[model samples]
Target: MRIYLYLIAGITSALIGWNIGQFFLTDLGLFSSFPELILYPCIAISLAIGMVLNEIFISSPTRPKLCLKKAKFPVLIALGLGLIIGLFSGAIAQILFLPFFGIPAVIVRIVGWLLIGVAVGLAEGLTWRWETVEAGDKKRFLHRLIASIGGAMGASFLAAILFEVVRVFLQEMPKNLRLAEDPIGFSVLGLFLGLTFSLTSSPSYLVALRAGSGFEYVSQIFAQISPESINLSKDYPRIDQSVLTFVSDSSLDRIEEGLSIKLPSKGSFKIGSNNDCHIYIPSLPDHVATIEIKSREAILIPHVLYFNHIAINGEDLKTKKNIVLKHNYLVTFYSILKGENNSENTIIINHEKIFRFVYYNRFFDPQG
Candidate 1:
């Protein structure tokens, strides 16, 4: 099953890679937008690269029998073999295509060669030590299919995020001074460039493997975290006066709806639900109202400031005057009072563990 899975991934990704290479070759002179041309290549390449690297580079790093049984270092063997084939094939393609595409011929053919190496590596992993299934099904075809898809998807997301970060940083470079190219914030170009270069990495395969393995749930959680962090509903609402935000079930009507997630790549990371959004208010005004989590036990997540008071079940809960929410390796919960410009914010009874407060800060004011 696993072997069959690997076979399918290799075949599909290679086809995608080939078509993309051809598209770039023929369309170099066309005026069409870049997004249409670039996305496929990036996705295909990233998917294939991730698949290949996982097989050749990471094959026997964990297994013990391979260390003593054959004594042949796998990485060196694979590298030597892959390098030879990659060079020969790359040279042939470039030598032929350069006449038609000119300088771009060299570039596209080199990319094609990389994609070919990916295909070869993926195919080898499927046929050789991959076992297709377990001792019984390890070498089987179905399981391989599931695993291959999972690996590819996971790698894709990581690739996308890494690309996004790089794109944002590069756009700010002083060298990109084409004021006429883009009159706006220059964000679109950053996204495009980042996604393009990132595809060469093939993160989807790596991600797909995780999706099929023990880390599937973790991947799902992280994928959801990125988007939920940007949801508009999570944004701090504009208020005419003091506003209390409670995410608990009873505090809101739609607390349990419309938050399904799809990874567009793997199963373990397929459809899921996640709605924990972190809120950040940089400069709270003096006239602003109090901010509270209002849970029975607030697991004071990291990044909290000025926790001066505490309240519990009832009575003057002998709360401490500290902001450290980490108590004995645990995220402790508590009620708190944070001082603002002239007044202080307070918390009441709750079942949860910890609460946090950001006080109205003005320490540099030497005026007593």
Candidate 2:
């Protein structure tokens, strides 16, 4: 289903660009070489934009919090590459001039479009590479770059071949009096281009949550509070049990545990007392905090209501809107009602519900 969507988007973009170029060609027919000058550029620009949009659409579900500001450079790269490849293709085709070099025009056009696909892939790969480079790991840079670029080129090559096959069939069809068959080949090329790219691109990241060093404190408190424990339901049976024990002096006998969950790599997730939140903490207020896990770092944004009670590494987040979470950072969400003084310097009365997790930069694999 998703492959179909990509194909449809790709094909539609190509045909639309081609038709728009044709419209311009007909409207401004003063020069004989206008079609040659205008048509390929239009197609290249459209394909470039289409490929980028397709990549975004495919990646948006997993990377919902991707910042456009950060993507400006890569988008420009893809557009530039696409235009250059298109012009190069046109020039090569004209210079070679169909069988002058003993190679077919179709082959030259295929190679040209192939390079365009490579451009799109290279842009996407660079975008992924750029995000990970900020994490200070240069070891995997070359490997990742090769993987992304290689996958895109491979997919584009396959798409080009498939498009050529389809074009052959289209060419044999009866002369079209109404609709031109030229756009059909472009549509086919676009369709396969998107589908193949999707297949070849890296898999989306899966967030990993394990018992961090801070969990030792919580674990010790849990052991001291209750000697005997009853079993609880596990939300995701595949992963390790993520248990959050709510221990109080008065409620030692009734130590309740909430279902712990691993956050998805999708950038933004709401965590609160609300049942609908990604992570539910009973002591925290409804919609207490938002966690945005990007390619480089994880950020925690506490709701204004629980500003005084929440603290990261003993420092209260009173005036701050969000904090970038580092490895072993203890994000303590204190119970507001049970606190003695809710001031920034003073600690809350019951601070046991601490979210202690390690942020692993390696968890986000651009190659995969």
Candidate 3:
């Protein structure tokens, strides 16, 4: 379903680009003749539109945070290469139209347009490659570049077909109404060109990325926090014969006394009393016993990247004491707690058994 949508978008964008290209040909002459004047704004607008669309559809769950930051250098390099190539192609076309070459002006102009389109497409494709390729695969630069160029050429051919159709339509319109003369009208036309190119280019780029090493790298990045990880933590709160319960309903309370219990293969848990005993009762006296629970036993593994902590119920019991049993022998309780060094931290427990861990950045929210 998503693939079809992307294809549709690509086709639509190509049509739009063709229309815009036709307008530029009619109003400003060959894109090669005014490469900087014509191509620069078009590139800027198209890239801006592409970035917005990428953020909306592609970034979440797949691309990492600060994707735009990572893409800056790549985008710059691609755009520079495109502009240089476009200008050079245009210059060549102009030379071919001279008396020495004896090439028809119209033919030269048409060829120039094709070259510019191909250059821009290739550059745009290269930009996508940087975002999709894995850091480890940077050595395979030539292979990725060749693949991007091929995809760009295909996209440009599609755009050319659309441009011819738009040109015919514009020719049918009244001469005065067909072209924009004022600044406001030109701005609108530029925006239209940008949106059209973005729609077409993004879909094509995504398809190319999927077909090459791009998809592999994107999958690798997302696999770190995939559904498997979430599922592993989902079945954390089950109970059996033995339960390890906290003394206070709030995990923020300082626990001075520790308790020891021979938890069955399946473990159990409950909240203990606030009094000196600080233990969950109603179980066999022989099986459950209270001892001095040290602060270090209740460990907080801070996820610095996410600003949350995975509070292990008794990590020390498994690691230090080497306690073992059946069924993995490890009873894990996942909780999201918000705190900093020597601060009043609180854990938000939801009824759905899902933990919402929030950490307040002291620099951002001092009161938190």
Q: Each prediction's Cα lDDT score?
A: 0.31, 0.56, 0.36
Per-candidate RMSD vs. true structure? 21.1, 14.9, 19.0
- Could you give the candidate ranking by TM-score, starting with the highest? 2, 3, 1
Candidate 2 backbone clash number? 1
Candidate 2 regions exceeding 4 Å error are 1-5, 30-37, 56-66, 130-141, 177-179, 210-368
What are the models' TM-scores?
0.24, 0.51, 0.37
Candidate 1 ranges beyond 4 A from true positions = 1-77, 101-120, 127-368
The Cα error of candidate 1 at residue 184, in Å, is 26
Please give the lDDT score at residue 340 for candidate 3: 59
Candidate scoring better on TM-score of 1 and 2: 2
Off by over 4 Å in 3: 1-65, 99-102, 132-135, 138-144, 180-368
The CA lDDT at 163 in model 1 is 40
Better of 2 and 3 by lDDT: 2
lDDT of 1 by residue, 296-359 (tens): 1113222223222232223222333322222112111232223354344433323342322222
Poorest lDDT segment (10 consecutive residues) of candidate 3: 206-215
